[model samples]
Target: MTVLTEPGVDAAASAPVLPAGPSQNARARRGAPSWAWLGLVPFAAYVILFLVVPTVLSVGSGFFTEDGTFTWGDVAALGDPVVVQTFANSAGLSLLTAVVGAIVGALVCYALLGMNPEGAVRSTVDAAAGVLAQFGGVMLAFAFIATIGIQGVVTVFLQDALGIDIYAGGTWLYELPGLVLPYIYFQIPLMVITFMPALAALKPQWAEANLTLGGTRASFWLRIGIPVLAPSFLASLLLLFANAFSSYATAAALASQGSQIVPLQIRTALTSETVLGRENLAGALALGMIAVVGVVMALSSLIQRRAARWQS
Candidate 1:
């Protein structure tokens, strides 16, 4: 017996079927809620207000006169002998602190590497590092002054006990040299905080594998550890350099008499009534600082990218 189907029913069923669009669950998974971006709003606003706005104003002000007419004289002041010396001083101090801090901090990280990461000692050091790293500005300067300045606790004690005077040459604590110790003080902790993670990121499996190949500890470090950590070390060093270079308050508080560094030079330009022919010199000095810091940070970012390869 032959069966008869409804007209067009068999033909319609034979037509090719299209795939359905993504399900509601998948669409939901792919798209985030609009409110989720609210978290970034505060951070974006902060950058715009504090960093971007100030940088634009400071750098832009350099090219204009007090009358708001554009001129190159203020920027030309950067070539003044005093200004050049100040830049050199800042660069030298920053380099010294960065080198010393990076080495000492790397050693500390190495010492802590074998300790229990979650142990009391490690946790305490981490916490202390975080705090001390941020312990700069006038507070840090005051601490150093109290400890080692003329008639300071340590200075007095040494003079009385050993008949040795720290200020026999002069009161260096109030000079550019005084900044060295304070900068290094905070620089070390900052280094520890920044470099510790890179040191910790070193894989133990690599060490074991090295040993499996009959390599010694020193051999592994010399061949593997040093190479891998070099990028991170360099990056941290640049960060420390930037930190010291941009510091104003500590240097201002301690070395109040002279514009020996760029930051202090900017202060002098801004506050000194006797400053001649450079009304906007402060802005020019700030522009120079921005250039130096921008270059240093750019290098740091490039090095960090290289370091991230091994970290991952």
Candidate 2:
């Protein structure tokens, strides 16, 4: 076939033409639709009403005294001996639970990884973990009370069958030790959920490559595996710590006798009938808790970013 072209028309002119930038209306159409923004209204309203408002109120209340005059008295009161002890106890509990939970949960995740990914056992464990991780508050405390409290089934059985009385050692079930058990119970499951994806992200080829180089299993882990998973592990640990730090209902239900932890102390400050002008103190305590949680979460986010690079 013969074709003719104009002298000034280059072959490039035959190529398909593309539009310059989109028009204002076209750009507007490409942007989020009105309904999409509308979809976020409920969530935005929720955050403003619940999170933003409460945080503002708590932080603002902390900076004021009974006479509505600004003061640092409430914040300074956080340094009181009893308050300091409460914070120390809370930190200790969070650290203990986070460490234990990370260890146990990582072990559990490793075990799951060894199983068939599609197997019922792995599915069941994941499902159970999802449920148990969120299983806290009054119900969890009641479960513990029924199982291991002074007159609990296990306690009663041990006392009757083996002459071993759990409470004979001064009823430790209502103390810090008691709180630790329940906190760990929930913490482990949460750690499992948070750490599993990181564990799964470990490609088999890495280990195979290590073996190709005659690396021992222990050496492979000590060199590559540990280093690769460290960030995720640390992030999960921080999350567990924050989770334990902010927990309230389980501790409240168990430790009814005293405010051994910061959350309990805040509760006492806010609710004690005999105490007056402690509401501001409660706000101060909440602000401190917020700061601790904020730092932990921030660290977790940084670690997660580092982990994402490797996982990707």
Q: What is the TM-score of each candidate against the true structure?
A: 0.91, 0.90
Whole-model lDDT, model 1: 0.91
**Distance (Å) between predicted and true CA of 247, model 2?**
0.3
What is the lDDT, from 0 to 100, of the residue 67 in candidate 1? Answer: 75
lDDT of 2 by residue, 44-83 (tens): 9999999889888879889987778999999999899999
Query: Between which residue pairs do clashes occur in model 1?
Result: none
Candidate 1: stretches off by over 4 Å? 1-33
The candidate maximizing TM-score is: 1
Give lDDT tens digits, candidate 1, residues 109-187. 9899999999999999999999999998899988988899886899999999999998999988889888899999999
Alpha carbon lDDT of each predicted model: 0.91, 0.92
Worst window of 10 by summed lDDT in candidate 1? 11-20
Clashing pairs in 2: none
Specify the highest-lDDT model's number. Answer: 2
Give the number of colliding residue pairs in candidate 2: 0
